[model samples]
Every structure is written in structure tokens, then in C-alpha cells.
Target chain A: MDIPTFDDVLAAQDRIGPHVHRTPVLTNGQLGDLAGASLFFKCENFQKVGAFKARGACNAVFSLTDEEAKRGVATHSSGNHGQAIAYAAGRRGIHSTIVMPKTAAKPKFDGVRGYGGEVVTCPPGTRSREEAVAAVLERTGANFIHPFDDAHVIAGQGTCGLELLQDAGHLDAIVAPVGGGGLISGTCLAASGFSPATKVYAAEPEQADDACRSKRAGHIVEDDAPQTIADGLKASLKPLTFHFVANHVSEVLTVSEKEIVDAMRLVWERMKIVIEPSSAVAVAAVLKNRELFAGQRVGIILTGGNVDLDRLPWAG
Target chain B: MDIPTFDDVLAAQDRIGPHVHRTPVLTNGQLGDLAGASLFFKCENFQKVGAFKARGACNAVFSLTDEEAKRGVATHSSGNHGQAIAYAAGRRGIHSTIVMPKTAAKPKFDGVRGYGGEVVTCPPGTRSREEAVAAVLERTGANFIHPFDDAHVIAGQGTCGLELLQDAGHLDAIVAPVGGGGLISGTCLAASGFSPATKVYAAEPEQADDACRSKRAGHIVEDDAPQTIADGLKASLKPLTFHFVANHVSEVLTVSEKEIVDAMRLVWERMKIVIEPSSAVAVAAVLKNRELFAGQRVGIILTGGNVDLDRLPWAG
Candidate 1:
């Protein structure tokens, strides 16, 4: 398998530049004081579809050949990625299908549909979702766009790190939440190519600590039915992402469920921005181990701001 | 009562330039579609102290003479204004006292105190709060910084409108929530001075529709104890603000409590920004009166993002 280089990321950036938002970098004096570090938050929460997934999905859909795009694009995600692909495909005037679990939240399905994507629901599980997607592919001949594992997706995600480095030059470290590791892997590639001295760290929820365990054990570690409030960070890293994580990532840190919620509330209160729990994991990691980031210029990737309004974690 | 001129606002902008954020103007395609207009949101929600109050507060604090600065400043507020004044005073290396009703939420008091302001709790009511503020002024020789209805404060609030017009030039109309009418009054002054043809509108909650009623009645109609979810917009218009509203404001629109909450949720879900109910009032007005603003370029001032997270209107 060929790894995506910095040049591929630049090409991906050009492809998605018109489609995706160059999301702003935000900072708060209160947040900085609390974390004991100068923090620059790459606010992908404000990105199209309210997540950084839009960048990768835009790159993937736009990268498709005219003949390939004519058939349409398909993905299985009850999350930001599903909405992102739908949005990207809709923007390009192409049909898109999203395969979601029947048990998934109504908003998730509605979000995809709102972006003009057709939704095909299956029973709740990886096997069921995959089978449903495959059936749809066979029936419609739509191209399958993997949520995180594709080279184009990683290259697109790398644009976020590139923007961060450009906006806040010479960061001491960069932190991002790790699920399937698409964002962090892309970040690592960007950092390696652009600013090799800047360290890249992956943050994970303790309940969904597959990435942390995989980094320690020197291999891909799968987590079956992992439970965490950070619904977006539940997936296990794939081989493509694991390869980059093993080769380039400086560390993988894990924080408790409570800490993630606390960090989410802190950001909302201090920065007055709506960040989802997955984004808070990166903040929680920094807050938990303050010494590592103390007195340094750190970049934090706020991955998304998609949340169930009726069911806020703080409400409990 | 002296009305602040556009030149005063320009000066205030310079005074507060180093202290406050020239908040970004944000636009959402989905929100625009919903409102049936091209909308430019002046995101004072991302401003210092999470509100546009910071602009006024900074101007007020920074405008004081050296002797006046040494004497300190005081205000009676249980919302964003208190925090803003405290934050501004702290930044100016001066003391601040915030008088609040004892019945106010603990978070409000904490917010004021967090900004290094002395919190003085009084019995719940206009009279009691005034007495408490007066007592503080007498005791400490502190200048009373009115939350609104002051030339300096209105000049500061006008900076928001100045920035909005500068960023999103030639708006057909600009809408802002009216409480004490500082923001709308300032906006009116700025609009009248810079773009005479641009109409200025005020949005108010039906529960706290003093500004709307006052505009129609041709006088200041005080709502002694208005109750609204838009806590930041409960205050009635004072004479200074009433002058601007009567002479410069084109219209005042009121929306139901449900509309305010719905608009808040719509912004959070679509724009993915944490805006307070007061800010949502302007969006609600645009959404409610779609025909009036349809196909027009509208600038909506998102006044603030200071809210008690645990007591969210949607959670109930």
C-alpha cells in the first residue's frame, strides 16, 4: 500500500479548498490559564457539516473520476462522515447513499437525508452496516467511500494540520482525538513534512482505548462494542492509520469519561463554542497531563460540533 | 441626556481596540436557507467575556480619567453585563463591584466574582438593586457604570454595529435584540451615520417586549418585572436609549418564548455556535418575518453567549 505524501495533501487541499471551510483558530485566556499552556484551537467544529470530516469527504468525492462520480458515492456512518459525504456529493451534483443502523439516532439519519443523501438502514452492528452498504453498492453501482481508511481521506484530513502550522507557526506539539486515526494520521504526515520538530499526540477515551493500547503493543488493536460518551471516537484504528500512528505519532494518551465531559463543559463555558465530546478528549488529555504541554505553544484539533441537543452530557 | 454621536463610537472603537476582539462575521448556508435571506451574523458571542457587553465595558473602563480609574467602577447586573464590567475593570487594573439580586443564579454571582469583581447581593427587585449599588458607590466612591443608557456604554456597543457594517457592507437591514437598547441604539447611531439608507430593527421577546411597546406608544414603557428566557434582554429602555430607538430605529419586532428557544436551537444545530437566547431573538425575528427580509442581505448581531449550561431551555 502506498502512503500519501505531503504533495498528495497539497493536491487534496487544492481540490477541497473551494468546497471546505478554512475553519478559524480560536483561543481563550481563561482556557489557557486553566491548561497552563498557550493553546490554539483549530476549530473544525465550525467546518461544513460541523466537522473536519467534511474536508476528507470533499476531497474523496471530488477526486472521483467523472465516470465514477456519475454512479454516485456511498458510506456507512451514523456520524459526521456520513453527513460530510452527503454534503460533498450534493455540492458536486451527484447522488449519494448513507448506510446507517436502524437503532441510530433519528438526527443522524435526518442529517444525512438533509444533505440530499438517500439512507438505507440495517440492523445495528458493523457486519449489518457493511452488508447493507455492499447490497446498496451492488444494486446501484455506487462507489464505497471509506470513512477514514482511504488515502484521499487521509490526505484531505492533513490539510487541517497544514492550516494549523501555517496559522500558528512552530507549535511545540499538536493534539487530536483518535478513533480510526484518520485525522491524527493525516496530522502526523503534515507535521512530518512541514514541521518535523512539532510532536503529534493522539488522545482517546479510556473506555475506547484501542488506539492507546495499539500504540503500546506495536500493532492494531480492535475494540468490539466499546462504550463512551464520545460517540465519534469509538471505532478501532485500521491498518492504514495504524501504520502512520506507529511510525510518526509521539504518544497516545487516554482520559476518563468524566474528564472528557468536564473538558467539554469547560470549552463551552470559556470559549463559548459548541464542541462535541470527541473534540474534548484532546483537551482532556492536555488538562490531565498539564506538565507535558505546560509553557509550550500547543495546537488542539477540535474535530466536530455535532451533538444531540435534547441529550447534553451536562444535563445529567 | 446626551446621545453618543457616531464620532464618539469611532473614538470608543479606538479606545477598546487593544482590549476587545473585533469578532468575526459568520455566515451559514443552512441558516440562510431557513431565514430565506442572505444573513451575516456579527458573532459578538465570540467576543471577550462571551458577549458584546465587553465592547461597552472596555470603552467605559478605558474612557475613565486617571483619578476616575483610581476611584473604581460599579454596576448592577446579574448577567453578561456584570461579567463584562468585571472583566474590563480587571484588565484596566481597577476595582469593580457588581450588585446582583440575591435570587439570581449562583453562576451569575460566580461569573462576576471570577472577573475579580466584588459581588454585593441584594433583595430581588429594581429598588433593592439600586440601593445596593448606591451603597457600594457611597462606600467606595466608585463611579456607577450603567449597564446601558450611558453615552460611553452606548458608544462602546456601537462599535459592534460599526464592525458589522464594515465587514458586511451595505446590508439592507440590521437586526439586534433590545434590552436597555444599548446595542440597538448604538447600531442605529452607527447605521444612521455610515449608511443612512440601511434600516435598523430591534428584536425583543414577547415576554419582555418593553422596547417594542415603547416604540409604538411613542414613549418609554417600562416593564417593571418582565420575565423572559432571554435574560440578557429583560431590562426596559432608558431615556438615552429611547431617544435613539424613537428617532433612528425603523421597527421593533417581538417573538414568543417558543420562537426564541427554537431559534437558539436552530443556530446551535445549524451554525454549531453556542449563542444565548438574547442573540437568538434577532434570528427569531428574521425567521418569523421571512417575507420582510426575503432575498435581502441582513446583518444580525449575535449579542452574547453567556448562559447557564445546566439550565438550558432545550433541556427542559
Candidate 2:
């Protein structure tokens, strides 16, 4: 399998530049003081679909050939990626079909539909959702857009890291939350290509530490029904992402669910920006091991801000 | 009594330039679709103390004479102003004393104290808080910094408008939440100075509609114990702010408590930023009177993001 090169990321940036927001880099004196580091937050929460997923999705949809895009795009995601694909497809004036679990939150489905995507719901389970997506793809002949596994997606996510390096200059390290490892893999490539001195770290929830386990075991390790408040980070890394993680990533740090919630609250209070639990995992990793980031310039990727306001984790 | 000239705002900007953030002007497509107009949100919530009050407080602290600052600065505020004063004073390496109502939320007082300000508690009323502030002034020889009525504070707040016009050029109208009217007064001065064609409007919560009533009465009409979810906008407009409002304000629009909450939630969900209820009043005003602002380039001042996270208004 051919891996995406740094040039692909550059191409992705060129493709998605007009579509995605060049999200701002935010800092807080109080948050920095607490973490004992000069922290720069790359706020992808302020992205087009309130997540970094939009970059990859936009790149993929826009890069599609006229004949390929005529049939539309399909993806299976109950979160940001689903909405991202829908949004990107809508921007390209193409149809999008998002396969989601029937048990998924209504708001999640609504988000995809709100972007003008058609939602096809299956029974709750990864297998069921995948099968549903496969059936839809076979029937509609829609191009399958893997949420994090495709080269185009990885290249698109790399644009985020590219922007981070450009805006923040040289950083001691860059941390990103990992689920299927799309963001971290792209970050690794970006750092390797631009700021080779900057180490790339993946932050994962302890309950969903498949990425950590896979890194240690030297292979993809799937988590069996992993449950965490960070609903976005439950998926295990795929072979494409695992290859990048194994080759380039420095380490995968696991944070507890409690720590994720606390870090989310801290960002909301200090930075005064709404971020979902998934984004907080990166910050939690820095806070959990302060010595690693102490006195260093750390760039944390705030992946998304797509939380259900009525069901805040802290309120629970 | 001498009114604050536009040059004072320019001077304040220069003095406070290094201290405060040139907050970003944000726009959301969904929010614009809902309001039936193009909206430019000057996000003061991202300012140094998480509010536009930081500008005024910084100006006030930095502008003080050596002798006046040596004795420290004092103010009576149960919200953002107290915290702003403390933050600004701390930055200047001067002492700050904030007098607050005894019944004020612990978070508000804690915010002031967290910035190293000395806090004095009074009974829960304007008279008691003023007397407490007076007592502090007498004992510490501290220069009392009025939250909104003072010329320096108004000049400081006017910097927000200057920045707004600079960033979101040529707004047809500008809407800001009115409390003690310092922000709106400053906004008026800045708009008049730069973009004179831009009409300035004040948004007031119906629960604390003193500014609207005062405007109609053509005098200062105080609200005795006004109650609203917009805690920062409960104070009545003072003489200095009243003068600016009477002279320059286009109109004062009042929004109900429900509308305020809905608007706040709408911004939180769509914009994905943490903004206080007071800021929502301005957005609500635009939504309530869509005909007045429709098809216009409206600038909405998002005043602050300082809120007790645990005690969110929507949670109630």
C-alpha cells in the first residue's frame, strides 16, 4: 500500500484552503500557569463543522473526479466525521449518505441531516453500521469515504498540523487526541516534514486505549466495546493509521475519563471556548504528565466542539 | 461635567494595547441565516479578563498617576468589573480592593480574589455596596474606580468599538447590551468617531430595562433591585453613561428572559463559544426586531464569557 507523502498534505491544504477556516491559535495565561508550560491551542473546534474532520472531508470531496463525485459520497460516522462529510459534500453540491447506529443520539443524526446528508440507520454495533454502509455503497454506487482510514483523509488532517507549525513556529511537542489515529498520523507526517524537532504525541482515553495497546504490541489492537465520555475517541486505529503511528508517533498517552472531563471544564473556564471531551484528552495528557511539557512550548490540537449542550459531562 | 472625547478612546487603545487582546470578529452562517442578516460578533469574551471590562480596567490602572496608583484602586462590582479591576491592577503591580455584595456568588468574589485583589463584603444592595466602597476608599486612600460612570472607564470601553469598526468595517448598525451603559456609551463614541453612519443600539433585558425606560423618560430612571439572568447588566445607567446614551444611542431594545436564554443557547450551540447571558441580549435584540436589522451589516458586541459554569442559566 502506498502511504501519503508530505506533498499530499500540501495538496490537501491547497484543496481545502477555500473551504475550511484557518482556525485561530488561542492561549490563556492562567491555563499556561496551571500547566507550567507555554501552551498554544490550535482551535479546530472553531472549524467549518466544529472539528478538524472537515479538513480531510473537504479535501476528499473536492478532490473527487467529476464522474466519481456525480454518484456522491458515503461515510459511517455518528459524530464529527459524519457531519464533516455531509458539509463537504454539500459544499461540492453533491449528495452524501451517512450510516449511523440507530442507538446513536438524535442530535448526531440531526447534525448530518442538517448538512443535507441522508442518514441510513442500522442496529447498534460497529458491524451493523459497516454492513449498512456497504449496502448503501453497493446500491447507490456512492464513493466510500472512510472516516480516518483513507489516504486523502489522513492528508487532509495533516493540514491541521501544518497550520499549527506555521502559526506557532517551533514547538517542543505537538499533542493530538487519538481514536482511529487520523489526526495523530497526519500530525506525525506534518511534524516530520516541517518541524522534525517537534515530537508528536497521541492522547487516548484509558477506557479506549487501543492506540496505546497497539503501539506497545506493534500491531493494530481493537478495543472490545470501549466506553468513555469522549464518545469521539472510541474507535481503534486502522492499518493505514497504525502504519503511521508505528513509524512516526513518539508515544500514545492514556488519560482517565475523570481527567478528560476536568480538562474540558478547565478549558471552558479559562480559555472561554466550548470544546468537546475528545479535544480535552490532549490537554489532559499534558496536565497528567506536566514534567514532559514543563517550560516547553506545547501545541495542543483542540479537535472539535460538537458537544450536546443539554448533556454536559460535568453536569452529570 | 466634561464628557469623554473620541481621542480619549484612541489614547486608551494605545495605553491598553499591550495589555488586552485584539479579540477576533466571528461570524456563523447558521446564525446569520436565523437572524436574516449578516452578523459580525466582536468577541470581547476572548479579552484578557474574559470581558470587555478588561479594556476599561487596563486603561484606568495604566492611566493613573503615580501618587493615585500608589494608594491602589477600588471598585464595587458583583461581576466582571471587579475581576477586571483586580486583573488590570495585578498586571500594573498595584493593589486592588473590590467591594461586593455579601450575597454575591462565591465564584464572582473568588474571581476577584484569584487575581490578588482585596475583597470587602457589604449587604446585598446598591446602598450597602457603595457604603462599603466608600469605607474602603476612606481607609486605604484608594481611588474609587466607578464601574461604568467614570470617564476613564467609558473611554476604555470605547476601544472595543474602535477595534470592531477596524475589523468588521462599515457596519450598518452596532448593538451592545446595556448595564451601567459604559460599554454602549463607549461603543457610541467609537462608532461616531470612525463610522458615523453606523447607528449604535443598546440591548437591555426586560427584567432590567432601566436603560430603555431611562431613554424614553429622557433622564436616568433607576431600577430598584432589578433581576435578570444577565447578572452583569443589572446595574442602572449612571449620569456619565446616561449622557452618552441620551446624545448618541439610536434606540434601546428590551428582550424577555426567555428570549435571552434562547439566544444565549443558540450562540453557544452554533458559534461554539462560551459567552455570558449579557452578550446574548444584544443578539436577542437583533432577533426580536429582525425588520430593523434585516439586510444590514450588524455588529454585535459579545461582552463577556465570565459565568459560573456549575450554575448555568439553562441548567435551571
Candidate 3:
């Protein structure tokens, strides 16, 4: 697997600079007091398509050659990735196809469609999703963009970390939620070059602790549909993402589902910004392991803000 | 009656500059398209106390003379005003007595206390509330800071509009929700001096339409405890606030409870920001009167972001 370098991150930053928002870095005094850490939150929740996926998707779509661009892009995702791919493709004035599970939420389907992506649904399984994407690529001759496994996508995601280091000045540590490890691995690579002293950490749900287990086992570990409220973090790490996480990440912290929910509510109540469960995972890790971060300046990436308003986790 | 002039607003801006946030102005393309107008939202929801009440409260508290401040300040309120007084007083290192109704939510009581205010609970009624404040003033010789009637408070609230005009550049009209008319009155004064051509309008709940009727009758109209989901807007206008509304406000638009809730949800879903129902009143007005605002650049003040997570209006 080809690993993304710091130069690649800088190049991606230059290419996708005009497309994505350089989202604000926010801090809450009350939340800081609770965690016993001076916390700086890089708000990717305010990103276009409402997630950091925009950075990676835009980089991938924009990096395509003229011949590749004619066929457009295809991605298998039912969440923010699908929306980001569609939005990025739309910005490029290209046709895109999104393969989603039939069991995905209606808003997710709507979000992809709203961004101008043609959606194809399959049965709820890895095999089905892969088959659907293969069929779309075969029929349409579209270039398939893996959600988190592509080198261009990883480089694009690293820009988020590069920005955090630039905006936040100095951080003792940086924590990002690990899903398929795109964001976290990118963060690891960004920190490696931008701020060598800054330790990179990954936060994950205990229910879906494949990344955490893999770190200890010294290999890629996959879970068979392990469930968690952090719906964005259910995916296991791919070979490309695993390589970066294994080498550059300092630690992988896991938090209980209850801890994740509590952290999510704390941010909503204190910061007054809507963040999804995946973003809350990094906060949960900080709050749960206060000893490790106490009295230190730390940065956490707020990954996304897309959630069903009708079904808030805390609401009765 | 001492009506606050635009000069007082400018003075308040300088005095409260260090205490209050120079809140950001945001826009949404999708919402603008839906409204048929370009919308600029002054995000006072992200204010120091999570409400624009901080602007007025800070101005009032900081304007107090050293001798006068020694006796501390007192106010009769159970909502944002109560919390604002507490927060402002805390910032000034002075004692603040907030007289709240016993029927008020526990969180409101906690909010005031948490901000270092002395909470004095009275039996729920205007008579009891007045008596409670009177007793506190008589016992402690604290200066009574009338929530909306005071000149300093009105001038302080005016800073919000001044900031909106300064940040948003050119607005055809500015809309704010009318509660006791403090915010709307402030907007009127700000526009009169800074953006004279910009019309100032008020949005009010149909249930609490006393402001609308009062504007028509050319006199103050009191509601006998009007009920609405917008708890912050239940209070009727006082003479000081009524003067500004009658002389400067262009119109008072009223919206139904459903419209308010729908607008509130639309903002939450699209903007990914938490806003109170009172703030939603302004957005509802812009949506309800699309013809008046179509193709025009309109400014809407999002008043606050203080809401109970468990008791969302749309939640079961």
C-alpha cells in the first residue's frame, strides 16, 4: 500500500482549498473545566456536506484526469461519504453514482440524492454493497472512490489536521475519532510533519473496538457488524488506513456507549453546536481518561453534525 | 421616560466590548432559496450567556458607579434575563439578586445560581414578583435593573443590531422577535443611526400578539399571562420599550406556534445550530411574508440557544 506523505497533504490542501470551508476552531470553558484539559475543537461539523469527508472526496474527485472525469465517480457509502462524493462531483460538474444499503435511513438517501448523486440500493451486507458498486462501475465505467482507503482521500483528510495545527498554534496532543481510520490516519500523518512533538491518538467505541484491538494485535482486525450509536465509526480499518494508524498513532482509546452519549449531550448543552455521535467519541475519550490529558492543551476533531432530529439519543 | 438614543448604543458597545462576544453572522443558501430572500443571521445564540440578553446585562452592570455597584444589582426575571444578570454581575465581581418565580424550571434556577447570582424565589405572579423585588431592594438597597424598561438595557441590546449592520453590510430590513420589545427596540435605534434606510420589523407569537395590537392602538397593550412555546417572549412591552416600537418600528408580524416550531426545526436541520423558539419567531416571519422579503437582503437576529434537551417541542 502506498502511504500518503506530508507533501501529499500540502498538495491536497492547495488543490481543494477553494472547495471546502476552513471550519472554525471552537472552545467551551465549561467543557474544558469538566475534562480538566484546555480543549480546542476543530469544527469539521461545519464543513461542506457537514463532515470531513468533503475534504477527501473533493481531493479525489478533483485529482481525476480529464479522461477519468468524463466517466465521473462512484462510491459505496450510505452516510456522509455518499453526500460528500455527490457534492464534490456536482462542484466539478460531473455525474456520480452512490451505492447504499436498502436499510439505511431515509435522510441519508435523501442527502446523497439532494447533492445530485444517482443512488443504487443493495441488501444490507458488505458483499451486497461491493457487488452493487462493481455493477455500477462496470456499466458506467466510473472510477470507484473507496470511502477511506484511497491515497488521495487520505491526503485530503490530512488537511484537516494540518489546519488544526495551524489554527490552534500548539497542542500537546491531538485526538480524532477512528472509523475506517481515514480521519485519524490523516491526522497522524499531518501531525508527524506539522508538529512532530504533538502526539496523535484515536478514539473509538468499545462495541466496535476493531481499531483498538488491531493496535494491540499488531494487524488489521475486522468486526462482523459490531453495533454502536456512532454510526459513522462502524467500519473497520482498511490496509491503507491501518498502515498509518499502526506506525504513527500514539494510542487508541475506547469508550463505552454510555460515555459517548453523555459526551455528545455535554457538547450540545454547553457548546450549543450540533455534533454527531462519531465526533463525540473523541470527546468521550478525553472525558473518560482525564488523567492522561489533565492540564494539557489538546485538539479534538468534530467530524460531522448530521443526525435525525426526530430521534435524538437523549430525548425521550 | 428615558428613551435610549443611538449614542447610548455606541457607548454601550465600547463598555461591553470586552465582556460580550462579537458574534458571527452566518447565511444559508438553501434557507435563502426557500425564503426567496438572501438571509443573514446574526448569531447572538452564541453570545456570552447563550443569548443576546448578555449585551444589555453587561452594559447595565458595567455602567454602575463604584458606590452604586457596592449595593449590587437586582432584577425580577426567570428566563434569559435572570441568567444574564447573574453572568454579568459575576463578571463585574458584584452581588446580583435575581427574583424568579417558584414555578420556573429547575434548570433556570440552577442557571442563575451557577452564574453566582443569589436566587430569590417568589410565589408565581406579577404581584408576588414585584413584591419580591421590592423586598430585596428595601433590605439590601440593591439597584433595581428593570429587564426591558431601563435605558441602559435598551442601549445594551442595541449593540446586537449595530454589530449585525456592521458585519452584514447592507440589509434591506432587519427582523427581531418582540417580547418586552427590548431587542426590537434596540434594533430600531441601531438602524436609525447606522443604517437609516434599513427598515426594522418585529416578529411576535400570535398567542402573545399584544405587541401587534399595541402598535395598531398606538398604546401599550398588556397580555394577561399569554402562553406560548417561546417562553422568553411571554412578557408584554413596557412604556420605555413601547416608545421605540411605536416611533421607529416599521411593522409587527405575528406567526402561529406551528410556524415557529417548523422554522426552529428547519434551522436546526439545515444550519446545524441550536436556537430557541423565541429566535425562530424572526425566521418564521421572514418565511410567512415571502413577498415582502423576496430578493431582498434581510437580517434576522437569532436571540438565544438555551433549551432543555429532553423537552424538545417536536420530540415525543
All models, DockQ values? Answer: 0.86, 0.86, 0.79
TM-scores for all candidates: the values are: 0.98, 0.98, 0.99
TM-score of chain A for the candidates in order shown: 0.99, 0.98, 0.99
> What lDDT is obtained when candidate 3 is compared to the true structure?
0.94
Clashing pairs in 2: none
lDDT of 2 by residue, B1-316 (tens): 6689899999999999998999999988888888899999999999988899999999989999988899999998888999999999999999999988888888887889889999999888767877888889899999888898888999999999999999997899999999999999999999989999999999999999999999999999999988899988988988899998898999999999999999999998888899999999999999999899889999999999988788788884
- Over the stretch A1-316, how does candidate 1's per-residue lDDT look in tens digits? 7678988888998999999899998877788888899999999999999999999999999999999999999999989999999999999999999999899888888899989999999998878888899899999999899989999999999999999999987899999999998999899989998999999999999999999899889988899899999999999999999998888999999999999999999998888889999999999999998899999999999999999888899787
Candidate achieving the largest TM-score? 3
Best by DockQ: 2
Docking class of 3: medium
User: Model 1 clash pairs?
Assistant: none
| Candidate 3 displacement at residue A28 in angstroms | 1.3
Candidate topping lDDT: 3
lDDT of 2: 0.92
Q: Write the per-residue lDDT of candidate 3 for residues B93-139, one digit (tens) a residue.
A: 99999999999999999999999999999999989999999999999
